[model samples]
Target: MGKGHTSANGGSRTEGYQYDINEKSILGDEWCSMYSTTAPIKFEKSHFETAMMHLIREPNINSTAILRADILREAVFEIEPNGKPKVKEEKTQDLEVTDPEAKKIGIDDLDVRVAPTNPLLNLHVVIQIVRRIIPRNLYKDAIMNQTCLIMNSSSSKPSTSLVVYTPHIKAEDECPFYIPHVKAVGILFHNNVLSVHYIPFDNVELLRDESQRAVRTAWRLLQTAYKHSMGIMEGYEKRVNHDQVVDKVDFQDCYIAFKKRYSKFLVDNWAESTDPKKHVFEDIAIAAFLFELWKKIYGKDFKEKIQFKDLGCGNGALCYILISEGIRGKGIDARRRKSWSIYPPDVQAALKEQVIVPSLLLRPHPEVRKRIPHLEHNGGLFPVKVAHELIAPATIVYSSEDLLQSPQVNVTEFSPDTFIIGNHSDELTCWIPLLGYPFIVIPCCSHNFSGERVRFNVRKSTLQSSSKSLGNSTYAGLVDHVEYIANRVGWKVEKEMLRIPSTRNAAIIGYENPFLDQFPTQEVYDVIIEDGGPDNWIQNTMALMKRNPRSH
Candidate 1:
């Protein structure tokens, strides 16, 4: 009499007949077929005809099979305590559930709690899978799709855990699809279900060529958004533009000098003069602005005992300005030449005359001349007479080469309150902060452990995800890395948009606050290791400094 019943002779009869049905096959179709030849049929009448006989009989084979099939069906889509289907909704249309409680039920929505947070574990798994899958083109679409799906699931809005995996749609054979930037992936939560919106890959063949590009695009977008939000881009732009101008001027001057020395070579080369004076003038203006910045931050006293070390003291123009201000400064560089001849003879003569005033005057006094012969030859008792007095212990000790790499010098020898200024320290940007001195670094190029060039680490992901290399000599990407590193090391970092000479902008200014307790020496090493492992610049410097503290 049940649903799985039939009569003899194929008659449409139903009373106490039983038949077994395949639950798997039945569920495959939307509608179940009854009395079909595919289903086994059985019947029993005597067992039920006489109630006095007690209808005692053996278990019906057909009935037992039918019961087993029904049990399997129940297991597949068993109702939960809330009276909602427990199975995942595979079809998108099937997701349209009216019950608010049932709406959150979906395939990807199952909550699997993980404890003891480890972010790198997931990334490592993904990376390993990617590396193992040869011919990356084959799985490119899947990987991109997965990225989009995961990114979209992370909702900005508060919601219960619910996931939905959209079925892949058939793609046209000739159509092309490109992945969108990772930063553009938008996540939304509606009715407790997370929705991910991302670009679907059409051609998997381009994966190998496009992988790096896609990652870079994503990172750049993220970085741009962060910089804009933080209002650092405007400042960065000004500094970069100023720096470019300064560089152009120096390049032009060098070119002119070469041409002047070799007229035949210049004619043969047919190189025309490019006037970079305008750029030089602009740089001067930028320098003035920097001076104003220093004044504003430290007041007029900034010119006092405070020593500024131009890490890469090119041309010594800045040093000249500081010297004019009576600041004790020294300029060091790998390349040294006597260009003082460029000054007029009268000026030079005046300097020379003043330098020998003491010697000239003390010549008559044997006692004075013996003590100061150099000065006594020129004049009485005094040496180097000029409009302004020069201060002692150079205000700036900079070099084009790696100053920190030198075995005889340690950073601490500069001064306890020295300001490390990397106007454009190039590769030195990475090691600038490790000196444990107050620093102002303007990043130019990107450099990392593997030595691969990158713009920025746009993703707020793990540090390794952001690791990149130092490209051209002018790129200061390492400075940006140092910014992140300094913060982790507990140095109060500040960024100011300097109105400077180049477009390669953004200056990370850091200071050691006396109020805060000094970070443990070991902690410094820990930070370096944590930030993209160890590198030669960091390891060697630390080792050398440890061995010879006075040499740093």
Candidate 2:
């Protein structure tokens, strides 16, 4: 080990011989002792090879590579046979090398252009890679480079045991104290025997518990992933399952920028019983997604073209982020949260405390609150006084004309350009799509139009399409139901399983409502009055408002 970094596996890496590697560039522990997997060792080498490569491309799949930000996952690129990268050039950073001659290595440059990083294999298919890793919180955007070598024998049955290797180039001074410089991971596949071989860095005395555990977990992830790839385990896929709706890079950049500006403010000062990190970070991610989504739908001038109204805005963190980012928006909640006071005056102003009453209940035909219907014969009447509308069959229960005329009932209509955000808006979830304005609603706790908590079911057909058997969970059912309502109301709905760190991250978006011209929403009216209408659902919502936090 001459002046560079070397592993305990005896694969000494001298700064002078760093580029001198070739077919002799080994992967596993030359000392033949370190770490290895125990169970699930029996697997075909071919299947294991595919899995090994997949894991190399995405180390974060097993959720053990958490010390860096997308380094081992998104940033790594394959070095093609022609010495060019397979990844887009714009996404890569300048490669690190002390030798200035690396870029201009010619035929006379002593075979320095390839080898170790691209080990030679005469008959097998060889894969060469240059990987990078950046510490998550130690220093922002600081990148460190590594390399991987995969040489697969075409006929696994005829070959001896093959040890695939991906070695890390350790940087002692640059490495975070919380993470190790390297964990030389090796894999052996021969005659139904598969085991991971891990070699800790040579300086075991300098290693910390955190870094050691990180390395241990890394090898475990390899074993688990290999088994899953061989169909020996179940669902060993990527951990953070973000949907491919918006550009991931754009979303991640937005999140990082937003977090840098607001995470401390929200987390340090949070007053809710819930863990601030979860709520704060999740909201930040959602805000990031919204920024990207709006930009996609309305171009770069989305903030100038659209104004948002976030219903059930809870702690108002999302509103704070959007407003701070120069997007004009207001967040309304049934009750004001303690965290709202920490925001600036302008941000605070964007949060309102008000219960929602859809225009359906406010547009009056009669004074139904009195319960004595002066014009009812046998059916389809406003019925008796109840908070949650218990209609006989088909009933639209949220609004009225007499109440608008009355000072007690406050009904506010949105402008044609208004964009509604029903984020965890409970009762407002179902109605957000029905309103003429476009909306993005994330259903949290399931609630009917009457503000009553109800566990809706996923239609038998929809359960199959959902990632989960949504029928088993109330939250998923509500998400599906909200989309259903939007579709019924002549709105072309879209859904994004948001990248936010919350399970209830499914966002149903309806940016284009074809029924905008149909102001009365006669179609919504028909849905409300289905099967016979609520027995007393007509006036139930308004009457029940007296009990909940959303009282008008």
Candidate 3:
């Protein structure tokens, strides 16, 4: 939410709220459209009215609470022309002050007799009361009426339809501006049906197109805007869960405490000047999640005992947090980040710079043969020389014995119970499951055999194909691919949408290592070999390894 420059309730200018409604980029217009999409909820007309009453009164706690708490960052109520209400912003800010003349009304005082006609109009005055992300003069068309009708006219449809609306403000205007008001409607009709309607203002489109094209030098502006809109639309839909948890982990208390401490430390230290809020909070969330997961798996005192290796640990922030919590872990990445140097000496020592090549890919050398005589190996060609600077480690066919030996055939080797953490691990997304250890992967980039971003054809289930589907994006397909690989390797998988600061928050957790016992280990390898021919697993694994000039 942007801060408002003036006070509407005759309070001090600094006391006013900010309206942060910046949807111009999403809608491709110089002026933000008063656009809203509808959702059909299950309820009778009377029931809907009751819900609406509750929603308007305590909207911060309603179904759309997250949007309010996150995106809007505040709850806004319509003020009758003559009536006043005390204002409250969801997040506490330095500029917040009370409007003494405004009398606050409780849910009991709210009149739900009329159906709210336009959400844009309903929240317009209050939105202007604080900050405006859009220009006030730009959408003079959206504010024809000052107040939104509490009750719909006598003939309006009943409880199932839900509409969400907000107005646009101008960049130049510090105060309220009104003119030709236009409204965009979203109708969620019968049987969970939905329709979004936007009024196309001719001049507005021309202004946006011409102005944006002039300023945007890159070709991705339009593509980025399209993706942004798609993401927002997807957010409006109800989330579906594909993996069910066999064992539950509760880390809410740990997360809350850690978040507070971590956030304060970040602000005080301030390593990266450019926007650390989102990244800082997200790393903290991951910390809390990992802590809880470890507690569940190894009992409450499981800290140093459960070792971890964070593959593709960008910035090594998570490694620092985990180590501070008394967990012994090392983070491996191809490239070291600047933020790594900012950590204390002890914390810095835990982060390692090396690309992790799965031991299954490398060929056995004399060192392995001498040290571990019982280690079994199958024949595979070593990496071919390319530009001579880089080396693509060959795929070393392994029996269960090699896994136990912890062979240093490549960059690093894993211990028996070492848990793998692939937090936004791009190329390593699919390899985590094949390593045959308990792991949790939160995939970010979509990549394939050649370490390239490629989309895989999704094999949707019968139910998913027939149902009202939220079509999969490249990211979602990648998540599915990771889950599929986990299943192929005989791992019991569970997925969770982590409570984090970023949009890419889904995690595929391979907690149950089905191949942990001797019989199943060989059985799982046999299935992998049979699935493709004996060499098929190697080919598939190699294709995903990042190729370089050193290994043509």
Candidate 4:
């Protein structure tokens, strides 16, 4: 009989030739399809029946009836070498059999003697039986089947193993696959990759430390530059006044000037008052500071040669200082001559010899002429006596009996290089710069372009703004207004804390460099026109000239 005709149980074949079932071939073709069908079939009987039917139905069946019958029996259960029922202990192990094509296959030995046998074990035995009966190629195709399973595995659980037949395993390039380790949190890339690093949020403190270091370095450079500029000024002063003593510098001059200007208060209160030295010390300190500041900004070349015109120059103390320093200077006021008469003997002699008395007071009223008998014969009276008494020039200039009521002064004749200095120029602060000279006005009243009285309006605006009040007095507002006007006209201005009597401690310093382009001359002219004619001390003198043409 042929190999397909006998049922092989271990080393023994059946005595009667029986047909062997092609169980492997049937299972390879129909296993997946039969499993998917909805029809119910008895697990025990249908396993053998299905295998037999598949073999019989094959058009190319070569096996005889006896061989097919034997194959069908083997499809249901494996047998032992003897015809006796197999013992459970002997049949538990799998049986290894060589097929006709010399390919090795495993079959599970069936144990019919075992009580209450497991169906899953029986099923495993039947599957092995099918493998032994099928062709090698068919068995290879059947073994290549793939399956996927999902389970609720924890992070610590091992991954399920994938069984792949060696010949059926796919290449890495065929379809890429990745296995990821579980993490608390991670970054995923498009390529199924993850990164492991991160940055913290508290790095701003590092940036702040770097910025502070840079600022400190910049401040040090600025201070160094300032000190270097001051040193240059000191060197220049030494060179310029080599013959003069150190006490004769503008700083010392400012001190003497302040004392001379406010001598009345000094003499009357200097000895009797407490803190007599305080005023002198304050003046020296302020002057020293001003000298240093000026030197740092504009070198020492200009201060010694700078020409100054003191408008409303009361007693000409500041002008005297500038002149004594060899600065080309001139002073004007309705009271300059009057102030000279009240000067101590030495100051009065120095003033009479050195300064020119250009314009004199015109006493339009008989009462004023009676007070100074020289006015009727000479078209003007000296200002030394008036400033000595601290008398207001407005009382004389605006007197009703004056030939020209509201008499005005013209300052143009006083030289183009002049910088008009209105030190405590009361009403003249509003009028001095309008005389076509560059000006530094320390104002003393609130008189405006129009003769309207300006009251303290501090609540309306800031003291920095022109409309606001500077202080409780008219003098304070006038100083504020002058500062506002100078800024409006594009003058580079500096406000200094002046060392002078009266708490109105502001001083303005203005310089005009001929090298600089001329200011809007037409605008300045319009301002002069708008201010209703120049009424400065010189302009008022000119008005006196025009009134009595032959007086000079």
Candidate 5:
């Protein structure tokens, strides 16, 4: 049972088991149940208590905190002559932060009177069910109603004990009787030992599973909190904290601006099955981060001097946002997304549909070059099964001398300060670093030079050294490999766990190297050529290509 959210059974025991009603009912109206569990044995009392406090303050610790769970608002507790606790008007910050003495309070240990701005708003059950079943319109209406009541609810008259208010289904509400209107969960810390207990009203047979889940979740949260306090939770921390690598550039302002200006349009026009909030939020964050990065590198006058090429830019929303921000950039992908049309004509012009092939591959095929005089500037290896007209319907190969004059062959040539952006660039993830320029690769699908989905064995040094090996998941391994490759190629690499909406958020960054003169283009070329090069890579890319009929 939770305080201000207790079971109907009137359970008020702290140390031993207590059952006020023993009769069992199908809906569980008569049985009273209390559950207790111990905390991790390794954690010292002080450390565990502090961790627990932190968990309450930051329930988003493991993304497990119930979205509606009551945040401690204001409360007062006083023990009456009889054992009942009396509540008085009290105001303060979250108890998790203000009340260190609260650690001594256990289940049914102290009666508290609370004035929460969010009484029912903190109910975990309400949050879970409403999110699943209620329509957005109804949910908004209910929230507005709750907000009005919360604002009007006076703190002048506090309840007796912390177990004051419980959620009961009213005529309009659909709460089950088995569920206690008000319940309280308590944690006790004494002499380096910890105990957790739940006080439910009459323990209904139906609530056994729910009660057990609550206990298990609490136990897990305790362990997580303990691990977080000790700084040993390498895996757990990564998921909770989004911005891992801090740079001089701050993109928060850019993100704020995007949300203020463009969020409604993006949300209304979202076409994918994935959550629109996350997709749009991620792009905004990317734009903000990139803009700041550009500002930091180019000083105040860094507009046209910096140009970007987004390899495998899906949907082209990011490119649109960047271009709209005054940074000149173009996105190239084997296929164009439908969202491309939604953009204005100017932004549409910045997006191109083309497959990228390393220039080195063209140099080796003399037979293909003889037929195409413009081999140096324009040469394409098409999929064996897919017709060229389907993929590159309007693509025209140009001469190397006219490289600067061609749109399709722009990838083959790079001017100084060209920035390669690889957001989920699948096959292009690994190649971005080898392109010998400043680039940011947010790897999604792992691929080798042959353009096949191949997972690289993450280096022991990189994996073991990383504080964020959340798991040996394939995605994490791929991100590690990309970071490792960037470092291996002598590109002063920097890795950041972006504050993006997606779980696959690691960004491998390469900037201008001070040792560029020592490790020039030839050195980069020698390394790749010696490592079997892109000799067979082009053939594989062409073989896998599937022409998009829609492009035609």
Candidate 6:
């Protein structure tokens, strides 16, 4: 929506029509001015039609933070036998376009086929209007309702297409470089060319200077949408479907309230080496997600239904936030972090130090723990036996003592009600889904089944699903790899692309469906064992259990 107007001098030539669009007479210059731009490239008629529809239905595609759009009414006009045009089908409801007192200034005349009261009445024209609602970014209390009108021409000869503008322009309505600013901005596809016409009240400068350039850029994008055979909101519907996997409204409300209470305090006194803003907001967002998820799963009384175990929880911020909100949970990591002391006593108590040796890994590996070889009471350990040559090498063999005495949680022993949170849990990320407990794992830097940092290669079949270009090195690939593993097991998985400050925001959730009897089955353990036996990992994990002098 440009501020200033160009002098209406040259009439535009309609592609197949014999007559030229007389600029001076078509748009009367009594109380306002106009600015127009034209391009010679031609576009498919459908391209023009689809773009117009997107401009109405999903205006947020071209702008930022626009809340919603609703079509108020649609009026289709047909040329009468006597050359005049009358409405054929219309749903005026409360918004009658023909109201004389409304002062809705629009196209004054059509120098081509329309000869009646106005060009909007041209034969086969559909006058569609939408009420766009946008909330102010910094000032949420303020909102604006701007009505956009789109008139598309008949599919027959002349080939002149849609024209976009506001229903009215008031001099006193001061606004930012927002679309249809103050007055009306028109985007027209006519005569195989693209054009932009801005109308401003004669007394007001409207959105000038910076707004001038912004409006030009806005129209240019509209032109780009037309030039290519795509809608500006091409995948808008698809995106909404993908994004709504979680309850967005509830998540947003929870996240904002949590951030307001905790962000400033944490950022001011962060004790970690990572960026405070990144870590703090991420934890806040994850905590918010969990709160909403727990509510849906266990109802409002979710606090008593289950407790969470966060394996490899970094910084313990997420545990702190959840515990502060009255949810009982614990954060376990390989080494204690300095940030633990910054939290209150409960969060401090919840943060425990130890490496996670999944109970599954400790099952078959007797060699993993030789029961303190130097201890006098301990009998000489016998040589391990092999069940089947293939299964023996792949699986771990450990006695009941290893399960009881070792400083690691046994996955099989956890109560069925435990909910696991794997916030960048590294080596444990893949194991969370397999642990048979309902869990959420957010993948960060690439890591294999072992904590040895190695990028997971995306499978060929998965790569071609939606993102054919998904490379092995990308975070998307890593997230997809986790999803693949979850699907390989029998657990029904739900994924949500979280709204956090960092790029590591994909949350993969696995659970047993309550309505349907669907729980995870370990049908894919052969391939899992082939990846790497637990011997190397067991030694590496045990090394971390040695205490580091606590950092102040």
TM-score of each: 0.33, 0.72, 0.51, 0.34, 0.58, 0.69
List the candidate numbers ranked by TM-score, top first. Answer: 2, 6, 5, 3, 4, 1
lDDT by residue for model 2 (1-552), tens: 122344444332222221111113233323222233334355555566567666655544544322322323222334468755455332333433332322211112111112221232222324545554333332332344444555454443544334333333334444433333444444555444454444445664332222345434434544564556566334344433454568765786667678878999999998777789888988998899899989999999888899998877888899999999999988876577888899999999878766555655545323442365563222223433433457554434332444444434334477666888877776667777877787889878886755566787787767766535243577877888888888888888777888666777888898776668865466777766662333343364444445544311
Q: Per-residue lDDT for 296 in model 4?
A: 48
Q: How many backbone clashes does candidate 3 have?
A: 32
lDDT (Cα, tens digit) per residue for candidate 4, span 1-552: 112222243111222211112222111221110001112212222222233233322211321111111121122233456523332422122333323332221223222211111122121222211112322132232211111111111211221111000111233222101101111111111111111111112332221221233222222222322233334434422211110112223443344344444544433433222343554344333334444444544467657534656655554444444454445665555433433454345444433222111221232233445688765423442221122247554423333223223323331335555566666555456655445456656555555543334543332354444323234355555555565556555566656545344455566655543422444334554554564533344333333322311100
RMSD of each: 26.9, 9.8, 14.2, 44.5, 12.7, 10.1
Report the Cα lDDT for candidate 3.
0.48
All candidates' lDDT scores?
0.34, 0.58, 0.48, 0.34, 0.51, 0.58
Indicate the worst ten consecutive residues by lDDT in candidate 6: 109-118
Best candidate, TM-score-wise? 2
**TM-score of candidate 5 relative to the true fold:** 0.58
Model 6 lDDT, full chain set: 0.58
Error of 6 at 529 (Å): 1.0
**Tens digit per residue, CA lDDT, model 1, 1-552:** 223222343223223221222211121122111112222212111111121011011111111211000000111133457644454322221112122222111223222221111222121000000000001122222211111111111223322121111222223332213333222232222232222222324432222231344423333332322223233313322212223212322333323233233333223432123223423333343345445455555677787746666654443444444444455545433222132233234322211100000011112233444577763222312111123257553223223133333443333335665676665544456555655667777776665432234354432342332222222223333544667776766667765444444555567777754422443234555655665643333233322222311100
Output the lDDT of residue 336, model 5: 66
* Predicted candidate 6 versus true structure: per-residue lDDT over 289-391, tens digit per residue: 8999989878999999999988887788889899999998788887888889999998999888766766555443233334544432222121233345465
As a TM-score, model 2 comes out at 0.72
Q: Model 4 segments beyond 4 Å from truth? A: 1-298, 336-410, 436-438, 450-453, 456-476, 512-520, 525-552
Candidate 3 lDDT over residue span 7-82, tens digit each: 3432111111111122332222323322122333333434433333333332223222111111223334544456
Residue pairs in clash, model 6: 364-396, 364-397, 365-396, 365-397, 366-397
